[model samples]
Target: MSLNFKDGRSDLKRDSLMAEEQALPPSYSVQPPRQEAPEDLSARLARLDLRSSVKNGMNVSADQCTAHLKLLEAFNQLREDIGQIPGLFGIEDPIFENPETPDTHQHVQSPQALAKVRVAEKRWSVYVARAVARFEKWYSTCVPATMGGAPCNRLTGNQFCTVKGLDRVAYHGLPIKQLTLPDQLPPLDVLMVWHSYMLNPRCFFEDCFRYGKLDFFATALPWTAIDPYIDIVTFEFKPSVQAVENFETSTGLCWSNLNDGMEKTFSCPRCLSTISVPWTQGSLWTIANEMTPGNGFADGDFLAHCRVCDTKITHDYLRVLKFKADVQAFMSPSDTPLPGTLLNKDGQPGKLTVLGSPPESFFPNSLLNAGLSHRFLLLLDNPNVSMSDVRSIWEQGLTDKNLVHKAKGVRTRLLPKERLSIRRMMSRYWFNSSPFALDLAGAVIRQGSFVEKMHNIDWLHSPALKSTMERLVQKYQRFFTLMAENPGKVAVPTLDVDLAWHTHQLNPLEYYSYSDKMCYGKYIDHDDKIEETALSDAFTWTSKAYADKYGEPYSECTCWYCEAIRESHTSKLDRFFKPNKVQALEKLHGVEVPSDPLNSPHISAHNAVRDPESEAKQRVKAAELDKAYHKACAKAKKKGKPEPRRDDYFYYYAWGYPMYMPLYYPYGVPVVGGGGFYPADPCMVNTGAGSYGACAAGTCGGMAAAGGACGGGSGGCGGGCGGGGGCGGGGGCGGGGGGCGGGGGC
Candidate 1:
């Protein structure tokens, strides 16, 4: 199968049984049953109430009782504020003056209540300050300033810098040396090998949300499998702090034994543009100071791109080495940098300490945070704006900065109606991490960007965003071959039944070694393997590594960063499959919902009681670049003027797009100006590395579940693999490989 890197599009037909067979995925999606909770339940909750989860979530704090009391007081404070809003307006009765109130009330801003609100505002600030302080304090407890094996370059947000050389930082199963063992490799295994190789980064993101390997996969990963890991440690301090010491501690590296034994390798120069699989052996090898196998691959073997130098090296001269470092950490809650724990250096970390590195913000972290940081601030800035209007404002802001042109290409070719199901059927289409993850610029806004001052992803790489062309070429090849053999048939990528049993995953502390005796042979010749990992919850997410490093053993989170969220969306069966159908039937018994928000026919009567101005009143402006981004969801259900721009290939994902979540757009791609979206402003672009679509980026502060690891927040590096599988030529994308994009340096 020839894997073409340039614009490889699928040729499979949708609705065809053959395509259906090709597109079927092992069931994975398991969404929350639509529980009809009272609409007022959310309205009654206060931000203070949510913050308590962070405190009382674990037994670590002995004052659960106190935390509860504080939270309730916060809640009462909110209620009082609501009651006083009318009084502040000098109205005798709020309900009588405004009988047509929208069921969903937004954050109420009563500047008139300024005199009465000061105390609460101050308290809220204090609470936030303490949380930030605790996070920093707890962080220093585990990380060292000069920590080696830090998850990233330590310079850019979401970007990881290679260990200066290949040998020193082969975190994945990348063989950094130039030696090899002779053997004939299987083609299928080769494909599988590439898939596993790509899984390194994706699994890293998954595991972060998943805690570690225990919860990530059903089985434990080999103790030393070179699984990819994201550096999750970042800290910030107030301006008053005279000195800022960003600390990191790590102890993962290989020296003499691994480095000296490694041999140089070469491959087709086009490998840069090709998908590499282990199906084939090294064209050449040298061991024991002798030329072994055939001569190594020539200069045409591959291209090595240095993200930092922006330099490309021909494969002919690519040689990487191994060098690892170990460091310890300690942080002080007070202004002064507490003496570091390492006995080697006095207070400072590492052998070489650079004085005056300047202060970096831990909360508005530029190192690892994805989209949540800036979008959260957007909400704070535009407390009055409706969700949809905020999106419009945000999008338009990007246009004013002239950043949308890159993304303006029509998504007509990407998952068009005729190909929607076909694309969905593609076996390797990973949704959470594919283009979305690679486009970390869209994930969160970082500090220190001048061109993109709003929310920049300066370290993001175009190739990385595209998963370095890894899965893209592979999927294209499969689709190409399938099209050649079956014509219009697109096959669904099913999971191995055994995947549920072993549930082994690629985690940073471990690498996956395909057990020969326990092979994933479900997809043998002419056989369809249906995986049941999601359906069966028999396995335990037990991990000593996670307990020591993070805390929880296993947790199930449905948020954007959740690996379960990433995997759940992988299968078509999961996408359209009916779960608990029998239960649904028994409960409904043909009863009709008179006012289902999701039901189409009940719209007329539903609107009669709805507030007409609920949306407009909610229209608040977004901070950073003010692109009317929140217009869509603003109780207003308002529509932005349609721009001349084209929707993304995956725009329809928005239909089922969770209401409160934000959507980060593709990287290197600029937003186009026009209608059916925000105006053609590009300030959003200049505002950051790439622009984050308003809604997807906006709705945040959602509680992070115990097991959730993949959201932009980094306890570790985070980004889903490029595709949700279904790589077979679905589009110019691949799933797995490179979690949501980090900074540019690789």
Candidate 2:
């Protein structure tokens, strides 16, 4: 009844031979509407999966109840008018299921479900009142730089969002909304969405930073391992290098995972504590790769050579880095000055001059023989990041493989299956389609390479990439032709993104990892060999200190696997959990490392309360404490910020304070007030979340530049809420797959 794999081709067998057999449900008669509301778990599950049956909008799992709930919440928010306080907020009956009883569910369609949505304009007012209270209070102490409706400020705070008119047509034909968020979310949703997806200052602050509507930023696998070692550049790439993440499902941007130039978190293997930073793109630089401006490190070559380790970091291991900057501006440009605007191009804000002569193509022959995604795949696996071997493969594509045996593009590889795996990863890699990374996407994947078999990636960039890159030659003057460059000597530009390569030990796979090509069956092992999996748990955090420091500890963990285990347990089995206790995530993605919560001391907390109902919910929770810890720890290491509570659970309380943002809310008290917390620095405005609107004044997002002093300053006095039902559903608040991988099994 299903497809089968044969000779690497997807083939399916059909049992029915009739050419046109129209099928009809045996029970098509419309069942009378239930007179009463279904309150049991069985009823709830039947109602849920029936809705889940909708086609096309898949969330990679059948159990997307929370995502659905979040979506419904978003819909309720949207149905209400956020422009006025009276028109915000709403809610509906929570949907759930229990294995104890699997039958008798009420299958409610959208019309029925929408009808069930209860819009309490009063309820929304309560939420808005609370938000306004906090927001207005935040405005009293500092200023906000609002541009295009999104604003950032130490007082206004980092990543607080409001609708600037995504619905309103801009001069350009593009939509106003940038990241994945529910349609027409209320003011609070906007605030959380902005912080969760854009400005997460939690890494440095203790529990003072809050998460957003969506959880991707928290579990964005890449940052887990990468964030601990890098520092986000205050400035973007030189006017158009582009971002590394696509953030298509959500309108947001992510930092790069490449070792180009960011912070590096290297540690002394013996002491297992923080070590002196040897790399930085700005000012201080001790890293060998950083010292060598254009010549990036050879891919397959990195000697761990930590004075304590005194050896190679090994091919199986990678030292990753992460840079935390507010990249929301890069999603779509605002009404900022163009000459001054730097968040464009294919990659980041930096410019990549191919130096002398850009090769007409890096691997022409290999490219001709292989798929587009495989091109970047080859780059990830290559021992040397140079272009010589790649050029040789292009030349050999017309001849034989002997002369070009080096790790050329997929075209020249002996293990074509591995090539396919890399190709597949590239097709779905999160950062491929963001407008910022379009050119780099072109560089990574060839046109037509992902036809049908991939995530249906965009191919429109090829021609544009070629055209834009072509201008670099004329811009630099006399750089020969694309093919005339010296293949043996490649010139790499400095991006200050060098931290991308260092492993933070969080969810490494969440960001991206380079691995050798292999068959699907073997690829898993190869992934393990590269061990690019995210490292969570206190151990990894203790060394690099990531995710939610001092918030919640992974219950069990000797290695990073512990966090993954927790994520799995929380996702699908919350019902089975014992009340009021946490679960340990003792599983891991890689075999070599023992990153699991079972080995941790915190497991005792959850073990005393485990039950069948909560089995799955625990797994989805790993992203919380572990994920945030890595990002914050890495950021702290980069700036030499004092490291305090990288592992304390109490820290999560401060995230709601507005002091952290200066562009929009623009206010907060010193460390003593506002719940015993303060901003990282007064008006520190260049993080990716704080960048776009943090510097602009009288913009759609705010009325003043960050730190410039807002007129209605209300310094930390927030509104109160009268809880009740939310607005009707379908506001798009929860449709963005914003839920945690909160329902997985161990």
Candidate 3:
């Protein structure tokens, strides 16, 4: 019986069933029943309500419960449908997030991302538009009924509260009483629109003007930032005629007249014909021709034509006539009525009228000359020019011969001490006790040194010394006068005399310190011996001991002489020792002074008055020589030949001076030139032992000039005087009536 399980009966049943399924029609084989339409929503709801009832202290109904369940099921189905759509539900979906594939966690979009970003934008835009429209409508018309009846001003919260004269109440959590809106305020979404529109800077003023009076918010607007615009508009518009007239009337109080009945007279330079015209009836012209165009009352040249002769007259000449008229008006006011006045002091009728002339003419002259000093008046009038320039020009004018002679007369009449006292007073008062006075005092001190040594007199008390100082000052005054008179002349002799005077006063040893002197004096001849040991002993034993005992250094013994001396040292010592000074001094004094102490040629002082006449002759001769030399040089140049060498001999004799020495000298001599001391003469060569070589090349021009006399002739030997020879530098006789070979001791 078990063997029959694997039989044909099972196969036959399966085949029959398959044949039956295959033979049936597709629609008849598997058919779904049609679904009835859902019960009408209102009918269903009515039935649910009718079926619903409360029982057993519980208000429960099957129908109502069923309806609620159905509603919940429907809601769940709706949620499912929404979730099926892209970007609708779940953490995987997003509506506003970017659709682009993102790599970072923050920028990552949901897996169920949307393709339409503009759709979201459109939806938001629709919301904003609706909100704005609602807000605008409400703001335009809505006003709190509680406030006294008035039109809505469409103002901001704070402005609205202010206009209503009501205190604002708080809203939400923020205590914004100033901006607390009324209860009838629109929704926050709509209010946001109004806020944005009001706060926008571009539209703020425009909205204020359109919705409310701008005057109410004038204080709130930034007036300063817009003031330039306001000023532009104001200037562009013209004021009324009455306003202009009022302004003119108000400003006319200060006006005064210039022209009267008295006519101004003008004299033409060409015709020499005088013409009279009214002072104020002329036209002014600019000096630059291009400044004005066309011929009219305003167009003319600066020079005016004479009415009778038609001759051009300068404006300056016209101004002179105007000045005379003004003077006459001031003096005879009754006749002219002071140009502008209609009534005199006695209340009488006036002659003429002019505007803005009296103040312009009268004030300047009267105030400038109102008992003030010339310097003060100059400072007041010409503020641009400095006081020093004015003073210099003034002092130059004081060099007039008549003024100088008068000053000399006054000085010569006074006693020497009285003259000194006056000079000191003048130095202190007129010179303001300034550095200029100090320099003048220094010059006097240096000049006085010669007289002091000659007469063996104390500079402080000796009347002779004071007189000598006055004479030196007088010499400088004369020099200034000569310079002022003949400024264009070359080779001024007064300057040479000044240089000689300065040279005589110079002492080469004055600049060195005691230590330097002791070190360097070993190489030069000196009147006093200086030893290094002695200097060291003085510095160490005396200076330290004095400082330890007195608490201060001995300043006078070792310190610099004066500010002037220090300045001189810094300036360079060769300035005092120029060879020109040596030659000039020899010419003036008729004696030889050793230029270099190492070259101990017989040097002596002589008593000789400096002949100013001789110096003047020499200056004239030098100028002629210079002109002739330049003419010769120019002729040579024109002929395409080399320029001639300067005649050194002629220069020395004619200019009455020598050329500069070679800059280098002995160790003790200051190296004050461009490089160092240089011996100019071969005979004066430095021997290192402080001795100078003998003159193998004979005498220098300076020696010959010193020995020559004023008149051209040799002197005969008498009373220890040698025979005078011709001057060695090409012209003149020996100045001192002595020959080089004579026993009188050349």
Q: What is the C-alpha RMSD of each candidate to the true structure, in Å?
A: 26.8, 31.2, 52.9
Positional deviation of residue 417's Cα in model 3 after best superposition, in angstroms: 18
- Model 3 local distance difference test score: 0.23
lDDT of each: 0.19, 0.20, 0.23
Encode model 3's per-residue lDDT on 1-746: one tens digit a residue.
00011111112222221121122111111223433753333333333342213222112233322232232222223222322344211112233334444333333222322212212222222233233334434443442211112222322322221222111110001111211222222333333343233211112222322233222112211111111111121111122344334322443311111111223343554366876543222221123211121111111223356666565443323322332333344334222211111111111111123322221112112211222124333442332333233323323323333432343333223232222121111111121111111112111111221222222212222222223233333332232222222212111111112222222111111101110121111101010101111111112222222223222221111111111111222212323644443233223223222222222111111111122223443355335435544664564467585443432321110011121222211111111111000001101111111121111111121111111111112211100011111111001111121211111100
Please rank every candidate by lDDT, starting with the best.
3, 2, 1
Model 2 C-alpha lDDT per residue in residues 425-539, reported as the tens digit of each score? 1111111111111112111111111111111111111222222222221211111110011211111100000011111111212211101011111000000000001111212
Q: Count the backbone clashes (under 3 Å) in each candidate.
A: 149, 194, 15
Alpha-carbon runs more than 4 Å astray in model 2: 1-421, 428-432, 436-746
Per-prediction TM-score to the true structure, in the order listed: 0.21, 0.18, 0.13
Off by over 4 Å in 1: 1-203, 206-379, 385-390, 397-502, 506-746
